[model samples]
Target chain A: MSSFAPVLHSEWLKIRSVRSQCLALAAVLVSTTAFSVLMCATLSAEDTSEAGFDPVRASFFGLNFGQIAAICFGSLAVAGEYRNGAVLVSLTAVPRRGLFYTAKLTVVGLLALAVGLLTSATCFVLGQAALGDLGVGIGEPGALRSVVGCGVYLALITLFAAGLAAVLRSAPAVMGFLIPFLLMLSFVLGDVSEGGGWVDFLPDRAGQQILLQNPDGPLNPWTGTGVLVLWVAAALWVGGRRLMRRDA
Target chain B: MTSIDVTQLTKEYGGRRAVDGLTFTVRPGKVTGFLGPNGAGKSTTMRLVLGLDRPTSGTATIGGRPYAEIDEPLRHVGALLDAQAAVGSRTGRDHLRILAATARIPARRVDDVLEQAGIASAADRRIKTYSLGMRQRLGIAAALLGDPEVVMLDEPSNGLDPEGIIWIRRHVRQLAAEGRAVLVSSHLMSETASFADHLVVLGKGRLLADTGMREFIEEWTTPRVRLRTTDDVRLSAVLAEKGFHPVADDDGRWTVEGARVEDIGPLTAEAGIPILELAGEEPSLEHAYLALTAGEAEYTAPRPTAAVQEV
Candidate 1:
């Protein structure tokens, strides 16, 4: 029954102390909103084919680029400790490996959640403004859910990257695997699978289910996010186990 | 007043043993020096104590429990295992702040420790810009943040300037004087000899010697008599005639082994030699360490070639 408040405070200070990690979080909002606005402004109603049009997803289109920033933020937060053996000092300060790790994850998770919500809401309002009559309202069906789901999606993606970073113990390694898998692999899998199959259940694709104006495939919006949550849980479990069993 | 007790602690990496059956107790109110050669398990043993690494067998306890079992561990034991273990981009003050927060210490203590470590002037600067000496100071500050009863520092004086080294020696002595247990590790015999009251020497992951500093030095190092006379040649001849072997150093001093000041004074007086300097030279910690680890050293540097030796 150890209190985690102090450890959480310390982890927050670690994240806030570095300029690059803060910049990474800020990028999540800026890149996602800016790219969504750009896409929305360029989109004309005449260009909308039934297969191509999805106003709710388009409003948060910058997520394609912004999510990378979120991943960088979470991965670096944990991986930076390993950069110069700072993890040894951290472990010394908090000898209970499980407590220290849980505190770290909590701080990163909350921060990502905050940034994710802000990015999702801002992208929605601004993208809808640019879309004119083509845009969906907050009261429209699935509109609020997609906006809120975008926030949860970003938070989960960041934690997922954080988990991988903890297990791998390097920012570059996490980025190398995550960036290609998220940006390229999803599209490649979609192409290989044609339209809809198990590929839609991939963590990213499954999570993005809520962001769509029209729900499709095997999972509902909440179930798709649940799949991403499972991925996050698996990653954190392995990372925590490694931290306890392996030598610092 | 708690003590660190390690009983038959062992750690194996793959097939090689990093720490093997090491047992020692570091009591409060003294600086126990952990001396060993490279790859001799000094760092590995410290890591095991801190619970940064799990032991393969046996146990290490602070007071009466393992490190993880203790609540508020920082308040019980403070350690500086590696001076360079700091985030480069964070300010020195912020680094201390983070650790201070984790220990549930007041924020004001961060400033106090920074001032105490003599790094107050550089506290606001980024750690990346700090010199190794500054980082060492910052690490020490972090260790003191919790004001624990036990302190462990590994190679604390390694990159320090003369003043910094003196500061550390005095600081460690003060910590011990305050009834805190201190365990400091170093490979340099001369450095540990300056301040450590007790010694724990290791070789190849095994304890080679564990005893008081003075006793270990006295038992292992030979006490010799050094004689500097007006007529060194005459002194050597007279000493040889008396069946005494005197080795002449480059400074024109004769080192007579297995003899005390009393033994050399009369011999020089009988030989009509004017003694300019007559002192008993106690063998240094370096000599005792060399003798203790003579056969157990992991790697030995090759002796100089004949040509270089002649020069």
Candidate 2:
């Protein structure tokens, strides 16, 4: 068996090379930070109660958009190889298909986690700076939980998309498959009364409960993150099977 | 030992047999040219050998071991089944770098292959910018990067210019000389005839010939004897007396088999036939190929007009 270093190195190289990945990463960083700053400016410009101007939720508001960018990047990290026919050479070199897929997921997954944590932390600090003595930061009740949850949420979204790509192997198709379910279906429908309880269990909707700014929500921050993590884990487990058994 | 042994290797998809019962052995220190027309299951066979596709019936083994069981199989068996089958957005060097990294080859070695393939200048360029010949060379470079004992390439000569063709021929011959097993596929026999020491010919999904180049040229190639004379009547009488059957083709050149040109000229002259043309058409590998796969050949080349003569 080949050492994991080179495999990881190759995977990292792939993540860094593509223009789309860079663009996606830039979108994640800039959008999250900018959105956090914008929310702070809005809060500071107007006089609002602590509940209405929760610094944690204000800073991490862009985690929603950040996750979308991360998911797109993560999905393409694996699927782009197939799109360009490099997967054949990749498989030819590694031979152990499952190991290859796992190595790729690990490197990209870790990178996503690092970026996710950094983005969330940076947004929290900057949002506090813009708070202008108005709202508390991570030191406040639920603020720390929200900040950490947002980071984990970003990483989970990326992993989930990466795993889905491993099975779909088509970036466009995976995006199409994920958009309605992750971005709209649950969140939009969950706002209504009848479907609210049921839609809250959907992956993205359940995942939002991790922010914890909504103290009266059905699930705690950890439980919401746990539900989303389970879904991501399932995607990876199934993707691993197809990666190993299916022809490259 | 045979570097590649494909025994009854069959690939079926939804009850359609893309390849069936393909059995052939590729040995070391020789170039085995795999010849087949398009859709003849050539690529499918190569994929099966690489274990990219599961065989429906039999197995494709390298040195008695399956491809999946071999760790870093590229080190033992390097393959280039498609020339432009690489990431288009990646630089040629980066492409090589990734493969080297995956196979655990040294980082510095990527430059060596770039130089070897005559693509050093283009190494930094994206594959999308490369010409067809450049991509083929890149593919060859990647195959040779492992310095493997066996190298398998499908239609490596495709889209190569004349000079590039000669370059590939020399490279394959050199690789074989270094004791590596070389398998190359092309639809044209003449393209690989001079380069391949042995051939594993395929038509449709079946093996047509598996032998050395020299033997295929000799055994199956038909030798044609041409004769001419001024005394056509006298020569005709002699031929009739000897029970020889002669039919003049378009150019009035009598194509007769089973006799040498020298023997025919003397025999016709002795019978008072004034000979104008006497030549024997030595069989080319092209002819042998035609004869071998006549039933399966999708395209039959017409005889050259010069080869047919007048009395």
Candidate 3:
């Protein structure tokens, strides 16, 4: 394979150069932070008194809205190449199909990681400030994990979208498939399964376990993250295989 | 010598084969013009050569190595597959810069190629706002940025203006002269005729003719001798007696097919018929191409006159 570092740099340049892709990354930060602070401030005292009200998880309620931007960022990173037939030019430069796809995913993953980490950390700090005395600290049980888990969740979601985009070869199509699947289908899967062990294997449900405190889910937070990573790995493997087999 | 060689290459898309068993070599130090009508597999063959499309069978290599094996492929082969193969939202300079990074080409080379392609003024402008001609130039700039040994351009002159067309013709010739292998594909016969030293004509996913430009034209077309003398009627009689079939046009110029200048010149001088102009009319590349692929073309335009002449 060609030198990985230069390809990584080139892919990074590709992501930074496009205005819409960068805008999507910015949306991930803006939407996540703004919503998290709002959710923390607006939480009713009566609602907090109810059972199973995890303040740390509730602080990240804005992630429900923020994940969309992360998905878009990932999808556009790969699908944009198919937009004006730019994939041909990209593959021509780096003819090894597997290496090119890997480089592209690495760039998207890293950018998402950076944006995800900053956004998650900011949201945690700002959301705690809004919660006043009721706010949780990094020293609190599962607080640090939830804070760090937010960034991991966002990055994994981004990689998932990137992989799906490669397979589908359309940003709109990948978004169409993922948005409903993440926003509504995960709940539907839980409701239908009645908290069955099968629901723990679903990517979003398994990943969200990391962000929850005193989770009743079968898998631990780290293991839940591992499940999401497996889904991402499977997705990327399929996408890479298709990319290598198909004509540019 | 950085030549491109393909042996029995084939690509099948479903039941249809886009490029079937194509075998040819594009040598360095000369511009080889790839000619075929639309759907004749010119683009498909190019994609196969560049390793964009996986061949169903056989191999295509550059300098005895598959394109996938080459590190920094842009440094070995510079190809302009499509002008629109770029992010329109980015400035033209950014597109070249990203590609330059891939090849580890210096940042200054981006500006140099922009100047070389005559798009220096529009380098910082977003590609979406640029014209089709400008996009083509930007693609050219990106291709030459790495200063690759082999250049493959598929229909580079399509969106170019007349001046741009001439410029590309001259540019490819210069690249070839500098000892780089240049393979250019075009449907424009006149454009290919001007700069190409060699020709590789394709028809219906198969090779039609692969030879030198002059030789291909000569082999496919009948060279005719055009004669204009003081007395056309006498000259026709004299040429008929000399075992030459000369056809007279309405303008009184007689043309003899399958004849050379040497045979006609001496006969005209011996007759002392006041030969005003006796010149050999070299067959055009267009006419020769049409003759060579007369029936092999996958799709031909409907002729208004509707007369099919046998070659």
Complex DockQ per candidate: 0.81, 0.65, 0.82
> Would you estimate the TM-scores of all the predictions?
0.92, 0.90, 0.95
Q: Judged by DockQ relative to the true structure, which candidate is superior, 2 or 3?
A: 3
Candidate 3 residue lDDT tens string, A56-103: 887788898899999999999999999899888899888887788888
Which pairs clash in the backbone of model 1?
none
Q: Which regions of candidate 2 deviate over 4 angstroms? A: A44-47, A50-53, A194-196, B227-253, B261-277, B296-311
Off by over 4 Å in 1: A49-52, B228-254, B262-276, B295-311
Deviation from native of the Cα of residue A220 in model 2, angstroms: 1.4
lDDT by residue (B172-249, candidate 3, tens digit) is: 999999999999999989999999999999887888889999998888899899988888877888889989999987
Tell me which of candidates 1 and 3 scores higher on lDDT. Answer: 1
Candidate 3 regions exceeding 4 Å error are A188-197, B295-311
The better-scoring model by DockQ among 1 and 2 is 1
Top TM-score model = 3
Superposing all C-alpha atoms, what RMSD in Å does each candidate have to the true structure? 4.1, 5.8, 3.4
lDDT of 2 at B122: 94
Interface RMSD of 2: 1.5
Predicted model with the maximum DockQ: 3
**Candidate 1 local lDDT, B185-246, one digit each (tens):** 99988889999999999888999999999999888888899888889789989988888799
Q: What tens-digit string does per-residue lDDT give for candidate 1 at A128-211?
A: 999888878899888999989999999999999999998999999999999998888888888888768888878899999999
